[model samples]
Target: MRLAGIHHVTAITADAPGNRRFYTGLLGMRLVKKTVNQDDVRAYHLFYADGIGAPGTDLTFFDWPVGPRVPGSHDLVRTGLRVAGSDALAWWQDRFARAGVAHGPVEERDGRAV
Candidate 1:
């Protein structure tokens, strides 16, 4: 089966405020919604998407606001999101560096500098 592209991706965040700041304020993604978790009233469900989300540009989070998950489901090592091109990557790299956001040096992967 051939997949066109990603419609959305979901992840868990230990810090909802920090997550909101980073994804929306820093990365420029818009907050689509902020809702409470049905199971856990203390938790939150934060959804973010690129401006006027079209395709391949939605990120959501199930937040546990109290603290980091220990010995549980939050073990994802990395999540890759594609941008316009190498130039855009360079721009983001510069932005990250300037903002003190930790990021690896841009490297080529699958013939694309990421």
Candidate 2:
């Protein structure tokens, strides 16, 4: 059996407005959809993606009131997104710096420049 790449990822966020702003404004992802959660109507479900709303590039969020996660071995910690090349990485690093976005230094990981 073979596995294809990711179609989308769904995560929860306590601050929908901030999340939307960061993803759309800062990172340049598109807001593909804004809808209510199916089972929980009060909560919002937001979909973000690349241009034209492509499948694999999409990220979904469940807007809910929540607290900081308790760090543990079993829980998910971070999400890593990719760019095209080292030049792009440098450009993003500069952009982040100029925009005052807090980020770690860009370094090579697993033979790939990030």
Candidate 3:
């Protein structure tokens, strides 16, 4: 069997408002929908994506106010999104700096500088 690629990724956020601001305001992603979790109506399930919220462009978040991770607990390490061209990385680097988003310098990964 073979796989094509990731369709979407979900994450937990302690501060939903801040997460929304960061992704939509800072990173320039569009909010596809603002909805609540089906199982837990009190929590927010925010879906963000490109301008039109394409299939593979989804980045979602679940609102959970768990205070910080306990020591030695398993946690999400990293998430990456691919841009169309090398120029996009350069643009993002500048955007990150301007928006005060901490990001590492683009380095070679899988034979491409991402």
Candidate 4:
């Protein structure tokens, strides 16, 4: 099947409030939607993204309290956000640094970053 782009990426989280704080407050993504998971009515499904809740910009979480953490097995992978250009990368790097968020040093990649 051909895909135009990603709709969203969903992840499991243990703490809903903490997740909300990190994504919305710290990361500066808008809390687009707050809802209950369909299969598990009590659990939450949170969506965060830029303005207007645009697709491909969303980062979603499913509250799964019983799930145990599994480390060192690639269970968690990094998510990369694509910025507009070198200027955007520079601006983002500065913003992240000021917020004390640890991120990789900016580097030239495919004619971007620089």
Highest lDDT scorer: 3
The Cα error of candidate 1 at residue 17, in Å, is: 0.7
28-106 per-residue lDDT for model 3 (tens digits): 8999999999999999999999998778899999998877777668887578877877899999999999878889998
Model 3 TM-score relative to the real fold: 0.87
Cα error, candidate 3, residue 89 (Å): 0.8
How many clashing pairs per prediction, in order? 0, 0, 0, 0
Candidate 1 has which clashing residue pairs, if any?
none
Which runs in model 2 stand beyond 4 Å of their true positions?
A: none
Task: Return the candidate ranking by TM-score, descending.
Answer: 2, 3, 1, 4
- Name the regions of candidate 3 deviating beyond 4 angstroms: 1-3, 70-72
What lDDT does the true structure give each of the candidates? 0.85, 0.89, 0.89, 0.84
Write out the backbone clash pairs for model 3. Answer: none
Residue 72 in candidate 1, Cα distance off native in Å: 12
Which candidate's TM-score is highest? 2
Report the Cα lDDT for candidate 3: 0.89
TM-score of decoy 2: 0.89
Q: Please write out the lDDT profile of model 1 over residues 1-114, one tens digit for every residue.
A: 999977788888878899999998889999988998788878899988889876678888888644554576657757887789888999999999999989999987788788
Q: Which 10 residues in a row give candidate 3 its minimum summed lDDT? A: 69-78
How close is every model to the real structure, measured as TM-score?
0.82, 0.89, 0.87, 0.76
